[model samples]
Target: MPDTSSYLNSLPAIFSEDPFLGQFLLAFEQVLTGLDAAKDEPKQGLEQTIANLSKLFDPSAIDTLFTDDEKTLKAFLQWLSGWTALSLRADWDTGQQQRFLAEIVPLYQRRGTKENLAQLLKIYTGLLPIIEEAPDRPFQIGVNSTVSSTISADTAQIGGGTPHRFRITVTMKSSSTDELARQRQIIQAIVDLQKPAHTYYELPILIRTDTMQIGSRSTVGVNTLLGSIPTA
Candidate 1:
């Protein structure tokens, strides 16, 4: 307080006497003010961009994107189509394609086995297929017979003269005409891929009744056979 006025007067004279130093101080002060005003906007924009990039590269978000839900599955498939070389069937819907992607690994693990075929049928139709193989010894006359003579019926062969034959039966509840037709197409496509090469196979679609009344006093709560569509 003793020399406050003298010190303040001396400070102004120090800068006013030097023109270059005065201009430099003025420019430096303006630069600092401008930096203070502009700093927040660029920082906010950079933070927003970093947040968006984090979400795009998040592992959990990527896993959720490929989950089994229909909408997500569709989006995943569309994205996968860019990188995957496998050809997807045009007739398969988003649900079927999702299932195919989910089960493809397991199916390949057990490929060429009956379990693989059954699994594929179950996945596509929601029904466990009844797989039947033809008689191992078509020439055998009877179960107790020891005769080994070959019968002419044994000569009969299936596809491409191969003796092996298989039959797959799919049971379904009766439904609308369009639904049944759609199911038939799905079943046919699955069977076509699951069947063995050069071997004859039959796919029979059996419709069953949900419930039936036997009489006025009795109700038979059994699934009755409706009809069958045989495919060879």
Candidate 2:
């Protein structure tokens, strides 16, 4: 198929002038071409098949086909994510996924630290998350602790740090409930995947209105990036 001609064209000089043989070879070549396209299919099957078989170890080479096939891009992204042990969010697009793959590996050395966690959160949410490695106060009895019969243990632990425990706060402008819920889900997933296995952290979403008022939020830290610092 290379030149759209049959290899029999190079036949022995004795048979080269055979008209019937020439016609047969040309007809057979056409049959093979149709079979190639029908059996294995075309670009679609070829792209996905290559992606599935290859481990995506060569990003530079595979990037060539990214624009050609969406399934190939997604499969490669997932393959790289599993390889790096990073549980990327489902909503992230091509650029975000690639950037995370590049950055997350270097972050492994700084895993479980405030900088590491904060950067990972930023990568997904586009906001610099506040990571309190050691909260100013731990869960205390009768002093700052709230007395409640319905306090769930899984609820975030705010204003507190205990053994292998910390708190994370991400402040954003007021948005739709659906948007907030989606952001919270993505943040939780990122924290759960990136945090130390034995460690626990509180994840609080602080919504700041345009006038710098709190919306379903508690305390505002001194390092807020969205608005002016609050003064007493």
Best by lDDT: 2
Predicted candidate 2 versus true structure: per-residue lDDT over 1-232, tens digit per residue = 2323354657776675666676566545554433234333342434455555553554444466577797779777887788887666788776667778878888989987778888888887888676765444445656546533222332234554346777777776679999999889888887887788998777777765434443333344443335443321
lDDT per residue, candidate 1, 114-194, as tens digits? Answer: 788788767666776767665454333353233322222233322223366676666666778897888778777766765
Name every residue pair that clashes in candidate 1. Answer: none
As a TM-score, model 1 comes out at: 0.47
Q: Pick by TM-score: which candidate is best?
A: 2
Residue 148 CA displacement from its true place in model 1, Å: 20
Residue range with the least summed lDDT across 10 consecutive positions in model 2:
147-156
* Cα lDDT for residue 12, candidate 1: 57
Which ranges of candidate 1 are over 4 A from the true structure?
1-73, 78-100, 139-162, 210-232
